[model samples]
Target: MAATMPAPAASGHNGRMLSTYPLLSSQIAFGLILAVGLYLFISERLRVDVTAMLILLALVLTGVLDSKQALSGFASEPAIIVAAVFVISGALAATGISERLGAWIGRAAGVHEWRTIAVVMPAVALLAAFTHHVMVTAMMLPLLLRHARDRQLPASRLLMPMSLAASLGTTLTLFSAPAFLLASDMLQRAGTDGLGIFSITPIGIALVLVGTSYMLGARWLLPKRSGTHGDDDYLRLDRYRTELLVVKDGRWTTRPLSELHKALGARFRLLGWLRDGVRRDDLTATSPLLAGDVLLVEASADELLSLHDDPGLDLNAIVRFNDTVSGEGAPQLVQAVVAPGSEFIGRSIRELDFARQFHAVIAGLWRREGDMADRLSDARLREGDLLVLYGRPSRFSDLAAHHGFLMLVPFAGEAKRRVHAPLALLILGVTILAAATEWLSAPLAFLMGAVAMVSTRCVDIQQAYRGIDVRIFVMIAGVIPLGIAMEQTGTADLLARGLSHMVAGWPALPILLVMFTAAALLTQVMSDAATTVLLGPVAISLARTLDLPPTPFVVCTALGAVVAFLTPIGHHGNLLILGPGQYRFGDFLRIGLPLTVVIALVSAWMARWLWLGGPLLPLSG
Candidate 1:
């Protein structure tokens, strides 16, 4: 089952390695590759996708696996399902079905804070169960923020619950997250029936209830800060930092001052006018621009930086680095996470012209560690900083890019298109019914659904392509070979035999708990997909050694992989809310530790009852 992949990840050393080497045994090669992969994974040396491919390359070069076996994950059922789900999620967003559902839920919010949360949080959880949780969070993010503004409640109170609920939703369905899908893929590859669509849903119900109740009872622990989602506070903290530069060959030199104001005034705020380094108060709306004249205008740091890209006027920082400069860097703010390959990523607001470029204002920014309002104008942008971008209805499409940015707050009374919603809904519903009812294979059903989205024009092909998170796709595909290598090399059996001896006399409950706890802990430090990939084969081998069903062990491993409540880095959804909730790293510990414990206990308990029925009684009997 060889696979095709995105050119970037599939290229590099793989080309030469395809030629092969017979120098080492497959076991030696597998062990060496595993060691190096672990080092790269832990050291944060390269992107996880790159590291995965490197591991694949090692496996093939040393003959641990053929190229087809090494790259099989790209064509696996899990990969197809995961990639297809992203497109379906995008179609929902494009047609505004998810947004419309979120808005309807928002309307249920009353003046009472708890009541409002009661309505919003569970609805978010339910929605997440079917669609991708990150998209669910992204869809609901704006609704909750709007409710916070309309009711004058704390935005902080709403965001963390929404994020947590989205994460918890992963457990409720077979395909909500890659961890679950991978779990199913592993089981199927082992010659067992894969997970049913709602197989773990009972456990999900318990976890969701536990999380919701915990957030409500511990409301006092939630941050009370104004959701730093608005740029108004930043405006108060610092006045306009950028001054407009009119070059000798400027595009706007012949245009009237009023005309320029009317065009970009919504973005780059024009305070007044200046000439020859002097503030000119007498400049009227009808005043004509001059070749060398300067205007006192306000723009975001990134927007100012983006001005360098303009064909006309240039930020003088290039001409005179020290002349009237605020700071350096392309500081592009984020809405949810920066769209994965966004032009704005890694650039500071000062480095790009967000205001004029995107026709948006950075009202508030949320970083994982600190409040950004203090240095709002010059803060460097990262992938997961939830930026409050205030722009008009016209800019919504570009701001979010068809569901690329999850959990972004939108302008009040944001217009949504219902025209395409019915067709999108029908396509998604048909796909789910066909798969859930066993009329079609999950992968085929989802693939058809994704294709339907494009054919039906619910979302264009470009949008569908954009919706797939290549990092996740490549990471999963790259690592699948590790499992294959482990099985093919007899390493899993070796490790499994050893584990059986240590737990010879113990009931399976405690061992299950241990396995679950280990998975949960590892998920905190790495991507859940990686954790699941590393541990899943071991769970399978161990179950076989003990003469017990592998399903529960695998299920528990997946459950733990998905329960990443203990840290923000555990999941992208957590980082999505990190800034909006104004949470500290310590806050996750205080809030999520208990939830993690509860989920672990509930998951192991359920897995035992569902799959084991009794502890492993006669190991190797």
Candidate 2:
């Protein structure tokens, strides 16, 4: 009779399992979308923003999320704060605040390589504590390049350290990186008080001190190449070339090439002469020019455009390419690189039509693995191709923000609104105060600052738009829905169960070490924001299973998601320095491995103290 009762119980259990299969299938669908989205983002086949949109569409169309939920990420607090931060940081750059700070570092950098690094790394870190690191890096890269060139310093010595410093600096503040915000949001959703602005200050300060000291010793590990070593090197790197027509009444007719040099001075170099489709390959300075001949010249983009005002020379085929070389606005020179998987990869610059697309002209194109002297219009761009672009100062900012390329220089010209520096600083200070004091939330405080910047003309509406980094906003917005799906579909619970089982019966500290290692390794290829969202709930769930406080695990997971020092692609700052620093994949592993270990240990210790209510190392009598 008891055996008969067991048969009924088994039947009931089987019925329940059959009923739950449809829900499980939906959860798996959302999981697959997340997997595909991450693959596309890391592969760089589509831009980050575009991949985000695709993820959002998948969630809504599959019924895992409704239309409103899919779009909720745009309305999230973190997205608002991030967008506003872009404008505020732009104001600082536009008002000359970043330049002024950079000059202070430059004055200290005189002659001694190590001394310059000591000052530069700390100062950059300090600035990053208060502002966005991406903004700081963008504003500082060109300034550092110009400073290094003028001082005859090696860029290899400064760029990697600066990028590393910026990455560390972001950890100092709650609002600096999207990881922290995501962690806080997760905690609030789990029915706990979220992280405060200065909750992690002690850990941040300790890491900065150790990191700064470590860099002093690590400087010898960097490559020692100089960015602009000599005049010939500069011309080769710039790769600026154009054809000029010798007019009938122009000064070059019947004159020696030496005479042309006498007129243009050191500004331009005559490469060769072309007449009736025949080229003179080896022309000396004494070679004579004739009317209607075409001269292939090497010059800066600025010098090339300044020719429009000169009567002696006119741009060859000026009628067909007038819009490009006509000198229509304030001229500025910028360096940008075609990114991997760029739509521009197989297209020529002439076909892409920069003048129509970006309001800019392609002055030259450089491929690191190929000859630098290739004709600009004829060269099909490949990944890592450095482009020398000329355009108006205002327009270059938008071009710099394009998803197809990475901007090496911030802008072609300095911000003309230097007088607004004080006002911009004041606004920024007030915003920080408001957030720290809890008078307003992080998003509101930053939005107010952005509004003040535009209203006071510290940055105009157009400049504010240029300053906005749409990729960051779109990425955060799209990933938020996926996070929601994780919780709603029981994926978070399933992951938590499996993870907790792996470390069952472990001590609290050891458990934290296990979780931190997993999060850090995942962060190497995945974004910090996405990593935080996925791991935060798992940490909380694990804590519940172990009957331990969840805060320490949550904080550990968040910090681990941010320490991506293993590869250049792991961090945006790393990618920003690749061209200027001339770094390879091996370079990061060499310098980053030891540093990552020390940081992980320090963070684990801090987590034990803050959440466990005891020191990591207990003293014995």
Candidate 3:
């Protein structure tokens, strides 16, 4: 029944009339309102996913798009591509490919910062240009974190640069990001030919060259944190001194240590025995403890707290007399920085109900430039601020994972289940084959890959859904209709006519540069795909008016849309690193501005030279 539904056509102006009338006026207005709404809601309180879904619902309700058309984006090729990319990335991560790659690069390049940056940045960039940057970030972040920790190199220096490289790299190939696919689809719908998979490679390679050069040079300009040596530096826990206590029921309270150890081995360890307050060094599993006996423990502060709450044991009297006792039974404490893209972003401790909600006591808050707040719950949490909380170990880990917060301390647990390398490679190969052979559409191929991952138990269905960013999916769906509405309303043509008149006498090169720069700048403020869809058609029209080849203009628009490197707000990858890198807004401006200029200049030159034949002037009327 769903498949039988009629395909919806755009109402109002047709393509021919759009060129003459006020084209895409409705679309522009709708897009602006939608964008503002998204920004406000996302900034204030609502989850991005919720906001996106609401927009989609509005579109369907308003008849801007039919239910089928509204849901089309979910089944679109780009969406599938993104989903498949996530799976491949997960498989690659599970197989430890990224870690092995980092280790190899580290060994080959030695410890010199520049050499390491050169080797790792290019490798990551190349991979990112061909796949999803999110996957690249997810796979590489942990590896780089571990590597930096191991080598005593400041993670602050590496994370941002690496994230930047991934963003830049995705600009190199048409299939590199979902934005490109969206652009390609828009172009096709606008009566322009779709771009080839590698059509943008020339300009993309140029951007990468210029961008990577800037990153390598900017490494010295970055701040270096003091502790960089591997896990030991971040995870040292000497402050925590744990001890155990036996339960005394006042009657029939004799139990052998062997029985307790066997029963609780998964949760606790009995280090030594105490009988009548005398310590016994030779305590074995079989040692018996009477009602008044105690057990000395050396475990994490979190572990000790967990045992304190166990129903079968009594730790109250023992904790009172233990020399390790701190304030009111609260154990050791440590400070940790909140990572970027963490669930804690835009959340207040009071809002999160830190104490009552998560059962943790807030101790202190630290920010880079702000004065320290006396109370943790009173401070408004921001990305990169360090938090000091008192809680059990398992509870902290749960909090970190639940909130997408990073553990500043080494994760002390068994590694998660991972997919085998060969199997993952096979799935990736099949996906590529499907895309290349056109045997299946890109979306279907990716969807199939996601299904394969789940069916094989390489990753669970729950994880597959989690792997896809539902917020991004909703944003794409809501925005895609706006593009269609733009085409339907004749706004795109009006904008193109205005631009053509403004650049009437300019050489093709400057006109092309202006269009590209406009797109690149707008991308910093809007979604890249939205920017491309709204602007690509206008760029194409401007080129046509000049009697210049449209290919160059299209390439420029696509390239510019993806090269949003000058600000954290420009791209998600940049935002992903903002917290972890401990970077300030100024840091992005300092490094990204120069990089953006270089990419813009190089991309324009490449488009002019390779496609436009030395910047042809507009045809005289």
User: Each model's TM-score?
Assistant: 0.67, 0.69, 0.63
**Candidate with maximal TM-score:** 2
Q: Candidates ranked by lDDT, best first? A: 2, 1, 3
What's model 3's overall lDDT? Answer: 0.63
Each model's C-alpha lDDT? 0.74, 0.76, 0.63
Query: In candidate 3, how many Å is residue 124 off?
Result: 1.2
Candidate 3 local Cα displacement, residue 265, angstroms: 27
| lDDT of each residue in 335-420, candidate 3, tens digit only | 56678887776776667665556555544344555443322344567787666555555555555665555564532322223224
Query: Candidate 3 — which residues are off by over 4 angstroms?
Result: 1-69, 145-154, 224-419, 437-440, 548-551, 609-621
Best-to-worst ranking by TM-score: 2, 1, 3
Preferred candidate (lDDT higher): 1 or 2: 2
- Model 2: residues with Cα > 4 Å off, grouped in runs: 1-15, 145-153, 227-414, 616-621
Output the worst ten-in-a-row residue range by lDDT, candidate 3. Answer: 410-419
